[model samples]
Target: MKKGGTAGTGATGRRGLLKRAAFGGVVAATGALAAPQVSRAQTVTWRFQSTWPARDIFHEYAADYVKRVNEMGGGRLRLELLPAGAVVPAFQLIDAVHAGTLDGGHGVSAYWFGRNKAFSLFGTAPPWFRDANNYLGWFHYGGGEALYNELITDILKLNVVGFQNGPMPTQPLGWFKNPIERVEQLRGLKFRTVGLATDLFNELGAAVVALPGGEIVPALERGVIDGAEFNNPSSDRALGFPDVAKVYMLQSFHQHTETFEILFNKPKFEALPAELKAILKYASESNSADMSWKLQDRYPKDLLEMTQRQGVRALTTPRPILEAQLQAWDRVVARLEGDTSSPAAGPFFKKVCDSQRDWCRRTGVFFLRNEAPSVLAFNHFFARG
Candidate 1:
């Protein structure tokens, strides 16, 4: 009887232990189901475009910006870059981005000059900057951003966010069918240029035709325009400028210093996480520095190739013409400053130009005075003895 009783007790205890174990298992599963699950962040993709033809170095520069952002973003963010005219024409980039047709774009601020002439003050007009780098310094540090915000938000009412990057070297006087030796040569010349440079050339007596970079070569080929300027040597070579024009006139005050503008839809950009926003900002900075280095390397090589091998005659634009361009800029500034009409470039134009000029007075003068003429160093080191 004692052995049977002990066996029954052990059996009962074993059953109780098994039931508790099963209950513990159910509780663990329930806890797991109730607790938050860990998963990867959802990847975001932006449809981006460039206001440049596919082959142009400008487009490549745009690609560089996109690459930096994408790699830094890892899988969390992706930017798909399309060439100009993929979704909208190059000039319409701001509008498209504003309307969410494109999430973002690479373009110059000057492209929006039609909306407000003050747009040119950001990167396209005046010779106040000692160089593109100085121009960028002004934009980033010299109260330019506040004014820019005012223009975009308070004035133009465009639903966009923009960052200024890609400091362009001084643009050339432009391409010509024949070398221009005199200021008089500009009169009645049909020239292709965009931005306030169009007004500058127009001021100098050229019948200005504002064509996008892609159309310049074709227009030149068809005799639709006689001369054009499209940024630097790599882009000029890429766009077949040599095939159409033999004389490449270098240096100009029109777009003395310029930078590319990277724009985003305000809503879309704001919707991004703080980490991603920081990525885009840093990416712009990275792109700017990288492009500066790359242009220093590539532009000289192409310029040499054009002059040495391609039978292209590259000439320094005559002093007379440059002085005349400066004068023209003065006139353009005055006219725009005086006009208080539809675009409201009058007071706004004065405001930006005054800011730039004050910044230049404090900064650019120092830069010019402190940096010895680079030509002297170039002649000392690289001059063929």
Candidate 2:
């Protein structure tokens, strides 16, 4: 039994050594084969179009979003930024996205209010919510997202993605040639506004015109409109509003927080693999965060500069006018609620407003009064700075 023991042991050791060598070789081959696949998976390209001017911060957010996505995706997703007029007419962005003519676009939600008055609720309102955090909370956690996506995917049948432009701050009521001291001043006053606000403005006996970003300046120049509201102070000044109009009034009560969107063609979005869809969603949310921070810092500073540099006079909105406007808005909500076609919109609107109001009453009052040190610390720093 012992005769061949040493010889058999040597043979078994040799076979074991060969098996180890084979496994090592197979692992090396697998590593080599997988390397290129991993590299190839790191590349993707997309295009984003916007109606905003290339120089506007609103558009700047779009550019930043591309960079953030590319970085966060570790070079897997690449988005190319296209200024207004690159893919389609700036005004036709919503249509382009819906038709799959373009990948996606940057546009204000109010622009599509023509599709339904209920759509305007996402943007802003007269005598409604003002704080940016409240607005963000409404969209993300207040059932607004569910209602919004359903409105697009279920009702309009488009694959639309949206994000916050954040609150544009207390916007100037508008550029006006005369003081609107009396309610009578509103009658026959031509204003530029979109959505259900137009109906409310009409009810107040004022004429409202819907115009695109490019058209507003020309219309103001030509006296097509007596007053206009485009955006915040910096944006308005950039558009040369000061040169054309005399009075820069305070607080866009009608637009406390206007939400904007970047809509994608539903079919195109759905066709993507799950990972790519995720990349898009993360990109949008990241964009919202970045934009909110920037605007919060930039808006108040810009307004201060306007007052100091341009000699812009800030007119206060009369309290009575604001109260009456709120009353009228209540009627607008009630009338829309009675119409069954927008049943979802009615409850959704009420819920957001109620939530926002509750937050305002509980926390907002102290913040505005500055009774609590932590209250509105961010707003105070920015406004005072």
Candidate 3:
């Protein structure tokens, strides 16, 4: 009986050991199955710098972009945001991104007109489109994107790729110490602007000083410039333009519409997984739409505040000055199209210009015929006596 009990006990111990081993094997298999997923979860991090001060709405836009990308990436990708001067000066963003000193950058293409005249076509050129929507349509669908890539990658050979965002509204004519009632007043009035508008202003006989927004107020206070236009009312107000000089011309053709450039190093961007690349590109478009909406909502209130609270004298720019700007743009475009000094100047610029002109011709007609007269509407609803 004792021998039989020992045999049964030994058999039971062996059965328990087998069960334990089988359970261990199952756990091991499960871990093996999950290993690839764990490895795939490794995160990719990128550093992005913006050509905007910490307080500017441009920086806020940049942050929003990073936020969307991060949430969409779901821990697989992360982007770090830095303000202007974080990596380099605001204007050096293109070069820094190209050099891989920055993983990415946000700025306006017009800031780099010194590199290639064609860049102005992507930025704040003269009044070619009726509004930001029309301009962005031309950019996305009207062959502007291809030409932009050719200029950045093929023509200039910069090791970067870019997208357009921040569909800006028509910029103000800017702040002046004295009211500009005639086109003649622009002559020799040390002015501040950027992009092709600089050339246009210079053509109109203004000694144009191409300074960034941060420097404009100081320049104005020191009497270094007689007039300046940075962007919208809020940004200009934030920069203290109202304190220094108060004759705010409420309209202009110099930069009727503009967009921001979002740049990434070519090699770095290519190294990203396909999904991540799409996220970066598509997020820019999303941000562009969001920015336009925000501007429309916020700018009107700010303009009113500047007038009602800050006691700013906002006046409509004279029609003669607008006509003069159009003439100056014609001359500037003619000179750019005719010059062959730079390889990318003549044909490439003309190609972009021709595309925009065709789009403008078609779309402008529709806008004029189909849209209600906005000036009359404004006069009816909001015009002050």
Candidate whose lDDT is highest = 1
Decoy 3 TM-score against native: 0.90
lDDT of 2 by residue, 145-172 (tens): 7767766766666655665554545555
Q: Rank the candidates by lDDT, best first.
A: 1, 3, 2
The candidate, 1 or 2, that scores higher on lDDT is 1
| Model 1 stretches astray by more than 4 angstroms | 1-41
For candidate 3, give the lDDT of residue 354: 93
Instruction: Write one digit per residue (lDDT tens) for candidate 1, span 41-77.
Output: 4678899999999999999999999999999986788
Error of 2 at 253 (Å): 1.8
- Pairs that collide, model 3: none
Candidate 1 TM-score, true structure as reference: 0.90
lDDT of 3 by residue, 195-248 (tens): 999889999999999887678899999999999999998787777887998789
Candidate 2 Cα outliers beyond 4 Å, as residue runs? 1-42, 340-385
- For each candidate, the alpha-carbon lDDT, in order, equals 0.90, 0.72, 0.87
Q: Model 3, which residues run further than 4 Å from truth? A: 1-41, 377-385
- The per-prediction CA RMSD against the true structure, in angstroms, equals 4.2, 5.0, 3.5
Native-referenced Cα lDDT, model 3:
0.87
